[model samples]
Target: MRLVRGALRAWRDSFDCGGRSVAMWFPGHMAKGLRQMKGKLQKVDCLVEVHDARIPFSGRNPVFQEALGVRPHLLLLNKMDLADLKEKSRILEQLKQEGLKNVIFTDCEREENIKEVVPLITELVSSNQRYQRAENVEYCIMVIGVPNVGKSSLINALRRLHLKKGKASQVGGEPGITKAVLTKIQVSERPVMYLIDTPGVLSPRIGSVETGLKLALCGTIRDYLVGEDVMADYLLYNLNKHQLFKYVERYGLDAPCDDIESVLKRVALKLGKTRKVKVLTGTGDVNVIAPDYNAAGYEFVRTFRKGELGKVMLD
Candidate 1:
């Protein structure tokens, strides 16, 4: 997509999260998942952390580094299809500077770049010290990541590639799809490899509201928790900031817009997302048809998530 350059109008420099606390967004189930993963750390040979490629620089749970970072790790940035990869090399370089040398971009749904996963895992484990597992020939890997980043999809993709098998884990579009640490599912046959799938967990204390919003935008967190209205606004802000104007054409707008309510109103009117509501007048009550802004906001956010508005780099 060719973005228009030159004198663009002003956009939001920052977003107001309405004083919503990060603690409210962190659910109890995620805490339990983290504890369960820690207990099974000793049995695993390598940690494959899957994350959304769009927000590569932010929204990662620090607990993964503090608790599970000791093992040989590979950071797999999933959902490559929805991310802007023009800056992929730069992103990798920044991650390398932070001591993360092993990284791969993958689209689990299409199973793109999945052929390289097994070999990469083998190389990482072989180069690192195996310790007590030196006598064991089979390899066991633990898949970890923030919520809804496609942990289960990656496992299923590997299984389809190596074992010629069907899904061993459940896949969904929302966060917290895998509720617990599941039993190991074999993905490769020749070298005898198995992967343990864990529920997506987030940090109990997120650093900032923007990080939380980014995670929410990527479906790492529940949409209602951050509010659909605010998320739609933030999405618009990022789209304009990056000069991604596909939304203007998609929603049938005459020009680019910064006001989320105005955009959503247009979307609601065009899509016929309206509801009849009773409003009291000075004389009597009358039913009036009004645009469902919530529904419109949801569709706007959904379109962006599906990459209909064009690829975005939220970091």
Candidate 2:
């Protein structure tokens, strides 16, 4: 990576949001999900909030805390395999300061730390007051988070780990996979534990544009809403800032670059992700090959999302 650093242009000190507002995509389904979740909160014993480990600090819906804060809460930062956690201690400290004392970093794919979830939830619920359901032995836990942060995967993982069962919930790369609060699925036979899955909700009012971009980059939000090209550019800016030049080697670039176009051009050419366009020649219109910037941007963003570039800490 250092081989490309000497010739690399000065990295961006700060990202410019370019007067873009935080993507406020609280669609009807999200609003409906929130209402349904609140309506069912009375029966829920605990709230297990899942989120992308890459952006642990950003994009958490404040509405969850305000409306459903009465229940025992456990924050699960899912997809830990894709995050840079050199400062995990600091992340936990900050979360503790913010009143999220019960936090767990999890990766559903490898089932990393999956076994600890039940014990931790049991402890948290046992220590806290269970409101009106004190006599109930079966624990009902609700999983909530922004879209595409592995809410369904966590439920499926728990079911697979504890019950030795197949998928209990649907998993997808896009947001809004679960449109409503799903029927509670039994994950454990011993404790009689059940989990409720809900559609990922976004806060109507985000903290900042940078926070929104981070969420978008993490696939918590739709790519089209943020514009693929712009998302790719912002991603490039971030990769350069962190000195993560895996793109240089992956895309066969000579060195790390600050310009998004140059890097994407190489990506498009190498991947053969080009399109045909008609050029207005003097004699007549002729077809020509043009690098598909939008497709290249989409691929770039998706590659990062898959953690192929490198583990990144966007928060």
RMSD of 1: 2.9
Q: Candidate 1 residues 175-291, lDDT tens each? A: 989999999999998778999999998887778878878998999988876788888999999998888989887779888888988999989988999999999999999999899
Q: lDDT of all predictions, in order shown?
A: 0.89, 0.90
Where is model 1 poorest over a 10-residue stretch in terms of lDDT? 1-10
| Cα error of candidate 2 at position 104, Å | 0.9
Clashing residue pairs, backbone N/CA/C < 3 A, model 2: none
Q: Give RMSD to native, each candidate.
A: 2.9, 2.2
lDDT of model number 1: 0.89
Cα misplacement distance, residue 269 of candidate 2 (Å): 0.6
lDDT of 1 at 184: 92
**Weakest lDDT window of 10 consecutive positions for candidate 2:** 1-10
Error of 2 at 260 (Å): 0.5
